[model samples]
Target chain A: MGNIFRFIARYHLFLLFAVFQSVALVLTFSNRSYHRSWFWNTTQEGTATILEAYTAAEEYVHLRKTNRALAEENARLRGLVEDSKYIGTVKRGGRKDTLQQYTYTAAHVINISFHKRNNYITIDRGFLHGIKPGQGVICPTGVVGVVNQVSRHYSSVIPLLHSRTRLSGSMSKTKHFGSVIWQGGNHRRAQMLDVPRQANIQLGDWVVSDTRSAMFPSGLRIGKVAAFSLDPESQSYVVDVRLSVDFASLQMVYVIDNLLKKEQVRLEESSAQEPE
Target chain B: MRHPLSALLWSIVALFFQVFVLGNVQLFGYLNPYLYPIIFILWPLSWNRATGLIVAFLMGFTIDFFEHSGGLQASAATLLFMIRPWIVRAVAPRSEMESMPLTLQAMGQPKFLTYTGMSLLIFHLWLFWWEAFDFFELFSILFRSILSAGVATVLVYTIQLFSLKSE
Candidate 1:
């Protein structure tokens, strides 16, 4: 008994170190999903105090621009809902056209970074504010980006200015569809590849987001096509597009929360239940 | 009169500042200045090893909780504190190397300051390199460590000067 007791005392320090290292390993490895971490609560509390000190300072400096942007957004949204009522074509003597429907929640940009190769923007709204991953963000003029990461008090968005930002967009008048990608050279310009030459297109032709997106509603204004050419390297046509949102001047945005997202996802998920 | 209690108190203050205040002020993206572990560096030569290790563990664990890096800092800090006695002995002045205070009063300003600064650089190198687990991109890792160390070294020196002045 005495011998065993002495051995335990001698090895206690090594055992303690092992315990601590294993705890660390669990923290690093076990929690790959961002949702699992308590980082949100802690970061929110800390940033709240920090941002409070900056809010008063921002009021006098950022007031005029923010107000004008909000007024412009309000005017544009009213026009979209009131004027452009999409008509449904009847097939087999029946027609189904959902009304112009979209819900918008105002969010303030808290922290943003475009310097990184994989850029992300964090806003001052989160799960509590009806913000979720895959929701589209927009400024007064056009589409901003999509929410990629979300927490209780903050959500990180991948901006349209990123080198890898991609969206499903199409030309307005012509039935031309292409994939939008940022060249990283300029914040305002994104290039669309995979366009077919069969469709009619022009330089100043308007382009907007499509219904193909799982989250963003159809016809959200993207930008205007800037330049186009049949690439010599590849047969597919490529067009330079000028995005609407000025990321440098971005202050406020609206997080669009689709009411039908949950029901749509559940229906798709259940259909995959059958064995392969 | 002995000053062990004062040293312990200052170390707690340093740890609090590092974990709470400095964690929020991220300079760019990856760089986080960890000045708390320097409390072990500035301890008097005669300060106990057990105290240094305990203080280092607490400091590292506090940082771990905030950064979600469980034991990486703790392990590096313990390793640094363990080797601190030998580094101090090697760099100390030949004449006043065995003195109790081991400060400028005992070993002149130049010799004592050189010893303190060099040992600190070595500690920073060990902590940052090990914390990163010797990745291939070692240049940027070392650069960040040096920049953070320079700022932290100034903070430590200021604290020491103020403490000495008060005394």
Candidate 2:
């Protein structure tokens, strides 16, 4: 009726604001999960392209640092090759056909955001390049993140700096396992929780990825314990770790292709299912 | 007020700067200066309320898309637009509100500071609070909100100073 129209006309701005706010809230809250809408994510073509261009322009400033990191990684890789050769020769008698467990694909980081609670990094490699979601990513110093979403030409990674990202980490010396999680304040530091007090944990003990994570290979470096305190309620020691990877200056990374990931996931899913 | 075309051009320039330059600048890890919301603050006061709200929404959504922040910026900026008129009526001079854009050049230094400061505070508090999105981290939210708002207000006033000087 005309009365309704009049009322609408009178408060149309408020109504419009409420409608827009509701839409924005839905987008904001719903996308907090691992599954995000394409429209607001960096994987969207327009935003990705713009970010790529900006990164490319700014890349020159960090060329020296990038070269240093790459050189260090090259040296580490060479050492690994030599070690593998030595192992092969030593175990020549029992060298049955060994199956490849993981493959590494080098990718360029096109864009990254670390200031947000759920930060993400975008790489140039994507589905076409054999990159898939849930794959692990790493750099020269340590583990980077896990692939969360992939398009044709790019993939988004959920970095360890994000609050939602949690990884199984263990002490290198004692093998005591804990959960590494970012507390949303600093990028360089993450908290490792659920470490029992009975473990002989020490300051500066290296923390590495545990064998339990299907996404990442065991023994990948995560960080070094910087501080620790006992939790009164859980009787577990909460430790702060200083991550090795400089997330701000990250440029190049290797995406891990776990060859047995599908098999492992299938087996786990089967075990999780109840009897029919 | 200037021509609508000019305002549109300025907005485009500001958007580009926000998306490309300022978006990348994160001081002290957590302090990100968001200068894009100035577009809403500087919008002509005489423009229609409904049109202004729509414009604010569009601007915010555009920035949110570029930031990949899932409409956080849009929600905060829209809230600012919703409360902007009341803020203007409260702080702005009567004559200035009737016939001028809400820029430092139009309003004197004191009024401009008050207006921009209040608007940016509300925008930033909404932004950081919604970003944290948890009541338990009320202290963290307040801390980050105030720090970021302080930095953003300084940047806004610096830009206003330069713009006024250029004019």
Candidate 3:
């Protein structure tokens, strides 16, 4: 007992290190997605909006140019709606849906964080303003992230820069599905894995969210395919996607709220419970 | 021996300067240099465990409140700080540590840099390691810790160098 006591007393620091490390690991694992620390969220967003407004005051003078750009965008969107009604890649798939499942509400980016391996962004709205978790966030160009956590007046989004954030996305032309994840290296480049090797991917092929994702509507823009190669061992293609929305330059984004997703999930759950 | 309280005052000043001032400065893009741990690094060697734990916890929790990672930074920082005495004893002799605060001036150049290097590496290595739970990408985590710590160490050294010159 004395020998044991002496050994422990002598090497107590290493023991403490191990114990502390284990506890910290447990804490990290349990909070895998991220615990929205409400203290800084409001301050960060509020401060950023103020700063942005102050800086963008000059840009505000060119309102006519902005108006023209928005009008052009609205017209292009109208064209897409018209074109999709008759001729889209998803001919039978989108039509089979009896009702609209998702809706996109546009909001300006209040704040953003990207240096950390698990980063998040804050938009200008929250639950009081009809925002919720699991909503898909996107810039006009491509997908940003799905909403992970929410506070009363603000919410944090798990951006594409985070290693934990993976989206079911696909090629815009070939319609190949793969999981898109941030490689934790660069903000602009994301990794798309689990793609079948048979798919002929080109350098500039467009990638978009697949129908598999409940939050994002099928075919919402993701990124351009930067690179792809076959994994010799597993025979799967690993595609590197250049994110369309540069998180560093995010100004405004639209949050797509899938109103019918919960109903759809519940229906699927109950149907799967048929005593099989 | 010079009054220990004055040396202790330097520790407090370091914490103050680090938290309220230098902590706000983001240099070299993502690197934020924090020297508050210098308080733990320089705790009077004669302090008892109860005082040590309390002081360490306060220092860590204060930063945690600012960083807003729930209780994570506090938990990790306090844990690292609590073990500092043992780290000092293990790495350096008690007689050398007796009345003096641990600093380059007290420990001399050779021992001081080595001690600080070891302590900082241990603290940061544990920090980023525990951050991800497991070795998701072990090499990358280690590289990040080393890179960030290297930059932080240089910043600390530069600050100390400049402050010493001013004094």
Candidate with top lDDT is 2
Model 1 C-alpha lDDT per residue in residues A209-262, reported as the tens digit of each score: 875665677777788888889977767789888887776566788888777777
* Candidate 1 Cα deviation (angstroms), residue B21: 6.1
Question: Per-residue lDDT tens digits of candidate 3, residues B1-167?
Answer: 13557645765676657544664353433343356666666566666555555555556545543333334555656676766666777767877766666766767666766666666666667665555445667776677677766666665566556756776
Question: Which clashing pairs does model 2 show?
Answer: none
List residue ranges in candidate 1 displaced over 4 A: A1-18, A31-96, A99-102, A108-127, A131-276, B1-32, B44-139, B154-167
* lDDT minimum window of 10 residues, candidate 2 chain A: A34-43
B1-167 in candidate 2: lDDT tens per residue? Answer: 26778778877887898877887776777777678888888887777878878877888888876655667888998899889878888887576588767887777888888888888888888988887777877887777777887888888889888978888
What are the per-residue Cα lDDT tens digits for candidate 2 across A114-223? 77666779898878999988899999899999998777788888899876688999999999999999878788999999998987889999999865768788888999
Candidate 3: CAPRI quality band: incorrect
True contacts kept of 3: 0.07
Model 2 misses residue B46 by how many Å? 1.2
**DockQ per candidate:** 0.15, 0.65, 0.20
- Score chain A of each prediction against the true chain A by TM-score and list the results: 0.74, 0.89, 0.74
Interface RMSD for candidates 1 onward, in order: 6.8, 1.7, 5.0
Question: Fraction of native contacts in model 2?
Answer: 0.63
**TM-score for every candidate vs. truth?**
0.56, 0.92, 0.76
Order by DockQ, highest first: 2, 3, 1
